[model samples]
Target: MTAHDTATAARVRALVAEELPRLVGIRRDLHMHPEIGYEEYRTSQVVVRELSDAGVAYAAGLAGGTGVLAHLPGEGARAVALRADMDALPIVERSGREWASRTPGRMHACGHDGHTAILIGTARVLARLAAERTLPHPITLVFQPAEEGGGGGKRMVDEGALDGRHFGPPVDRAFALHGWPDLPLGEVGTRRGAMMAASDRFEVHVSGTGAHAAWPHRSADPVVCAAAIVTALQSIVARNVDPLDAAVVSVTVMQAGEAMNVIPDRALLRGTYRSLSEETRSMLERRMTEVAEGVARAHGCTARCECIRGYPVTVNDDGAVAQFEQVARATLGDARVRTIAAPVMGGEDFAFFGPHASACYWALGLARPGIGCPALHAPDFDFADEALPTGVELMCRLALA
Candidate 1:
């Protein structure tokens, strides 16, 4: 490694060490009052307060109502954008911690609170660099809201968050990180290609003539048709799609008859579709429609299907991933940065930024020593405080590099 890069990495490590206490406090505060999706009003206010106090130039309410975009200008035109989601999930707190969520039925189970804190820490470090005239390139800090389900990333893009105004000449690279409980503490997991799947929701409505249960011949039971459609839809993944390719078609909700003695006239079924490729998504959609319609026709009923597309596949740029690997190796040594073999089926709205510029997303380990880590979206899930320094250093290095 060059002497300059070594000095820069050492500076980032020192900055992270200095900011660790404040970063932990911010994360705990966010954990105490968790908000869901597009309703991150109070969360956005806290971010604004922190950035304003740091004397960083920023734009509040950039995307819709909850997103905040802050810019730290440097000496060169080459710019980098760093993103952190600012939304919580609807899960009761069960972490048994002193600083657990005070609000009932909402918690930061997905580590978004931690993500936000790390980004804020990065901001503090970069602000210092800017003040000292040591920053090499501009950095864009994106505090995006509604990453849970509101597609706030897309909203920010629509509102010109990534336009050249924020980053000087548009972002040459974008970086983001999620807290991962499965990996060891201070470790980072990344890949060069698809790291997450595309998410899509579908609803099927089955219609038939209603009648009494005693006169079975007279009624075309919609519940029976819905059941058949559900069974057939499962085969689309097993029989139609390639065995080597990954796909998931789950029927999560089923609503039909209310009365015991009468057959319902309509039945509604809803679920989600997950795939790694656009071709797989299209194939699943077509096969699902065919299965619903064919099953209804066979049962003397009519069926209609509606598919709502969600986030797209998260594809990491090869060049950006290489840069991140270099930074990780330099900061944490060679053993901490490793390739992830399996791609997760979960979806992320950060995929929205992939179409605009080079993107690289990685996972920050949060598991505590001798303690079992909790899965995301669970009631007991909590962000580990020990990983705060690691996250802050990673972000600072990515930005300064």
Candidate 2:
């Protein structure tokens, strides 16, 4: 590294160290009270209050929901944006930490609390740098809600979160990070293309004549048809898609008769299909519908399928990926920065920003050696406190770089 870069990295580490305690406290507070989707009122309030305290300029009540936008001082025509999701899952908390989820059935199992705190910390550091007039370009902080499944990122874009037409200067580049439970703390992961899959939800409704439990050929059974449909759905991936293509077809939810003796007239099946490429995504949707109807027809039942198009596959800009690698390597030694081996099947709404601006969504390690951390979405999951400073430093350096 050059002498100037080395000095800057040292300076950033010191600043992040100074802010770590307060930021950790804030992160724990958020962990104690978790909110879901657009209901991140308290979380938004905390962000606004912190931003105000940090002397950062911001506007709340954005995105037609619980979203906040903050801007840092700089001198450039182009602006860079950073994102942090502020929502929790509906799982009951099982983590035995002192600052576990206070809200009964909601928890920050995905480490969004840490992400929010890290972004806030980054803002604090950049605000200080802006005071010293070291910022290269204006920075945009996006406190987005409903990233769990409600597509808050898309909502923010729809509400003009990225479009400079209404909010501020048009965002030229964007970035965000998700906590990774498998990797060790103080490490980061990044990839160039298709970092995550496109998630689409589907429902199959099967209808048939009700039949008595004792009767066999007296009436048509929708339960039988639904079971056959579920079994056949698996072939959509194994048989239809190319062997090299990545795809998953899971029938997560199924509903049928309520009584023990009588077969219901209709059955409802719900599940999600994920693919890393758009062609495979389309192929899965079409084949799933065709398979459902075709299988039900063979059983003397009629079936209809409904597919809800969700966020597209998350594709990272090559240039943004290179920049993130440099920033992460400089901020936290080169050994800590890693290129992911494969794309995760999970879904991310950050894909929305890729089309609007250059965007890169990376992962922050939350695990500790020997003391294996709980995987994300697990009830007992908690954000690692020790990783907070690393997250803060990486974000600050990325903004400055």
Candidate 3:
């Protein structure tokens, strides 16, 4: 390893050792008081206070509200960005822990609380480095809100949070971390490309004539047509798309009749589509619309489908992935940095930053040896405090490198 790598590794270890307790406290506090997307008022305040305590310069209320940007300038022109999402899923805390969520029916089930705390720890370490005049390149700490469902990262981009002043033109590098329950503690997993799938939502409306249940011949049954459309949609991925290309079409919602005997006039079907490629996404959309309309036509009904694109696939740049591997190996040791061979189906808003700059998003392990950790978005899911040092170390290494 080079001298810079050695220094960065040492800094990460030092920061992790110094900030572990503070990181755990912040994580537990955020976990107990969770908030949903676009309503991270308290979350933003905590972040601001922590940054202030660290003596870091920051801009609050970014992207209208609930977004914060803290900057730590370095000696070089090239700058890097470290991002953390700050929105919790609407899940009731079921971990049976003493620090369970205080808010009813809301919890940090997706580990956003941990992500925020780790980034704050990173801000503190980076601030110290800047104060000591040792950083080589500027670092921008992005405390983004609404990574659960809302496209807060995209919104931040639209509001110009990634502008040069925040970092620099075409941010030289960007990185983010997510806690993973499946991976064992003390390890990090990442791949060079397609770390996560693109998420898209679709709603199909089927309209038909309503009539008495006794006279079924006179009425066009939209429910039947909608069911057929749903079945046909499943075939698009299995038959139309290539088997090697990953794609998922799940019909999560179906609504039709209000009464047991009466035939409803309309039926609605809503679901999400996940794919790794643009071609598969487009093909799925086209096929879904065609299948819905064709099935409705066959049943003497009318159908319309609307597809809304969410976050794109999280793709890590080759060089950025290499850099992350180096940093991870140095910070956590070569045995702890695991190379992932396949991509996951989950979606992330961090993918938005990739279009603007070279980005790498990795998963921080949170599973313990004997404890069974709950998966993300589950009501029982909670971030493990032991993972705090690993997360902080990853962010600091990325920033310092």
Query: What are the lDDT scores of the predictions, listed in order?
Result: 0.90, 0.89, 0.87
- Tell me model 3's lDDT, rounded to 2 decimals: 0.87
- Candidate 1 least-lDDT 10 residues: 160-169
Clashing pairs in 3: none
RMSD of each: 1.2, 1.5, 1.5
| Candidate 2: residue 374 lDDT (0-100) | 92
How many residue pairs clash in each candidate at the backbone level? 0, 0, 0
lDDT of 1 by residue, 227-297 (tens): 99999998999998899889999999999999999998999999999999999999999999988998999
In candidate 2, what are the lDDT values of residues 60-147, reduced to their tens digit? 8876568988888576778889999999999999999999998999999999999999999999988876776557777888899999
Which candidate gets the maximum TM-score versus the true structure? 1
lDDT of 3 by residue, 1-401 (tens): 78766766776678678988888888999999999998999999999999999998888997659999888867677678889999988777788988899999889999999999999999997787677656878788889989887889988777766777554443668999999888889999899989999999999999999888887898999888888998889898889989888999999999999888888899999999999978788988999999889889999999999999998899899999999998788778899999887889999999999988899999899999898578888888889898888888778878877
Q: Which 10 successive residues of model 2 have the least lDDT summed?
A: 160-169
TM-score of every prediction relative to native: 0.97, 0.96, 0.96
User: What residue pairs are clashing in model 1?
Assistant: none
